[model samples]
Target: MLKTLPADSRPREKLLARGAAALSDTELLALLLRTGTRERGVLQMADEVLQRFGGIAGLLHTEPTALKAVSGLGGTAKRAELLAVMELARRAAAQQLKEREVFSSPDAVKRFLQLHLAHKAHEVFCVLFLDAQNRLVEMRELFHGTLTQTSVYPREVVKQALALHAASVVLAHNHPSGTVQPSRADEALTQTLKSALALIDVRVLDHVIVAPGDALSMAEKGLL
Candidate 1:
C-alpha cells in the first residue's frame, strides 16, 4: 500500500526533500526501521509500531521485547531503531566532550554524562580525572554493579586520581529505574568518595546521579 502511493509520498523521500524536521515521529523512525514483513513496507510498519509504543520517547524507553512484539517490527527493526537512538545520543555526547573542559564545573559533567549514562539499566560508576587547567584528562569506569551496590573503593579511586595528578574530579553513576532522587546509599557513597579524594587534594566537584530523562546533583541538593 505504501509503495503503491507516489514515490514522493514515501517517508524517506519526503524527509530528503523537506529535511528531517518535517517528518512525523513514525516517519523518522521509518527511515531507521527500514524494512518489514512481505505485505507492508517499512514506513507503514514503523507507523504501526510507533502507535503501539505510544510515541518517540515512549519507544525509546520501551523494552526490546515490547518493541519486538509489534507485528512488523521484529529483531531487525527493534535493534536498528535502538542502535540508532543510542548512536545519536553518543554523537551528542561526543560533541560536548570535545568542546568542554571536564573540571570547569559540575554542571558540565552532568550535562555530558546525562546523555549517555542516564538511561543505563545497571549501575555504572564513571570517573573523570581533570588536569590543572581543567582540560580533559581521562575517564575510567571503576566498576559496574547491581542495583544496591557498586564495588567502587575510594582508595583505588583516589590512587588513580593522584596518579593522574588531577586537579579535580566528578563522580557519575546511573539509576536504572529512572528516578533521579539520590538513594541513602548514593549519599553515603558520595561522602566516602569525597572524603577519600580530599586527602589527595583532588576536589570532588560533584557527584552526579543520573536516571532516564532526569538527574540529581549532590552539590545542588546540599548532599555535598
Candidate 2:
C-alpha cells in the first residue's frame, strides 16, 4: 500500500521532494492515477497500464474508448485528463512553431512532426506551406493511410500550395514501423511532388521522414 511505503518512495512525496524530472515514467503515471483499487497498488496499476498500452508513445496514440476499459484508471475522467494533457502538449509545440521562423528552426519543425505523426496508427502525409521568405503559412495533414503506405497525390499537393499562395513547401510523413529510412516509393513520391510544384514556381524545401525518435531529411541526404 502507498500509505505504508517509505515516504521517499511514494509518488507524490518523491515528486515534491525530488521534482517531476527525477521520477520514472511509471512513477509519474502513478501520480496521475492517484489511487489504486482494492486488488492492486497504484504503482502496479500504472505498470500494467503502461505494459498494456506499449508505453508512453502508445499511450499518446490511445483512443478514449479504449482507455475507458482500463480498470482503476478512473474511467472517463482519467481518459479526459490524459487527452487534455496530450492536446496541451501538442498546442504548445504548435505555438512554438507559430512564433518562430520555421525554416530557421528545423529542429522545432521536426519535433512538431514527430509529435504529430510518429505515434499515429497509420501513415499521414502532411505539408508545411511556406511564404516566399520561407516563413510558415500553415501546416496541414492532407492524407491518411494504412500501416505501410499512403497515397500522395502530387496534383492535390500542388493545388493546395497554389491555393495557399505558398512559394515553398516541406513534406513530412511518418513510418509507423519506426524506420526513418526513405524507401524507393518515398523517394519517387518526393521527386514527383517536386516536379509538380515547380510548374507553379513553388520549391520543395525538404521531405522529412519521421519515426519515433528519429527523423531523416531528404535535402540533407542530397536526395532533394
Candidate 3:
C-alpha cells in the first residue's frame, strides 16, 4: 500500500486530505510522529511500537529509552513521542482523578488518592478540600510520618481548609506495603482527626487508604 500509490498517497497526505479521524491509529500516530527512516514507513514504525510494547495498554507503561531501541525510532522522535504520551496520560489521569468527584463514592475517593498519593514510598497524610459544588479546591499534605507515626495536625488541616474556603475534605494516605486494609493506627487517627476537624465546620468527606493498585474508603465501610 505504501509503494503503489505515489508518495503523495502516503499516510501523511491521506491524513491531511481526509481529516485525522479517518486515519487508522497507526497512521494518526505516524503523522504526529513525522519521520521514521529509509527502511520503514510511518505505518511500519507505528506497527513496531505497537508490536514491541504489546499495543496501547503496554505502550502506556513503556519508557522512552526502551522505545528508542526500535530501529526507526532513534534520536529526538523517541523523546518527543514518549513525552507526548506521558504528558497526555498524566493530564488524563489528573482530570479523571478530580472530575465529577462524588466525594461520597468509595471508588471515587480511591481514584483521587491514586492520582495524588498511591505511588509514594513515604507515608504522606494529605487532605483534599472540596468546594460547595463538591469540586476540588485544594489538596495539602499536613504531615509526613515515619513508618510508624503518620500523625496529622488537625489545626493545620482546618487552617488550610479554611484558608482555601473549602466546604469539606477527604483525607488520604498511601500504604507502601500495597495493602488496602486500614491499620488500627489509621483508624484511630481518622477518628481523632475527624473529631478535631469537625469543630471547624469542615465535613470529613471520607478517609481513603491507597494501595499500589487498590484503595479503601473508611466512610464506605462505616468506619467514619
Clash statistics: count for each candidate: 0, 0, 0
The alpha-carbon deviation from the true structure for residue 221 of candidate 3, after best TM-score superposition, in angstroms, is 1.2
lDDT pick, better of 1 and 3 = 1
Q: How high a TM-score does candidate 2 get?
A: 0.83
Worst lDDT window (10 residues) for model 3? 103-112
- Per TM-score, what order, best first? 2, 1, 3
Worst 10 residues of 2 by lDDT: 57-66
The sequence of per-residue lDDT tens digits that candidate 1 reaches over residues 70-166 is 7766667468667678668656655565467654555666666766676556788998787776665777778899876678888889888988888
Q: Which candidate, 1 or 3, would have the higher TM-score against the true structure?
A: 1
- Stretches of candidate 1 off by over 4 Å are 6-9, 38-41, 47-85, 102-111, 133-135
Q: RMSD of each candidate?
A: 3.6, 2.7, 5.5
> Would you list the C-alpha lDDT of every candidate in the order shown?
0.74, 0.85, 0.72
lDDT of 1: 0.74
User: Over 4 Å off in model 3, which ranges?
Assistant: 1-90, 93-101, 104-108
Candidate 3 local Cα displacement, residue 137, angstroms? 0.5
Question: Largest TM-score belongs to which candidate?
Answer: 2
| Candidate 2: segments with Cα more than 4 A from true spot | 52-54, 63-69, 103-105, 132-135
In model 2, pairs of residues that clash are none
Better model by TM-score: candidate 2 vs candidate 3: 2
Cα deviation of 29, candidate 1, in Å: 1.5
Q: List model 3 lDDT by residue over 1-224, tens digit each.
A: 46566765577778777777777767766766666678777677887787776665455545557766777766775567666876576566546545666544556556556655655666889888888777777677888976545767778887898899988888888887768788888888888878887887778878888765578888878898
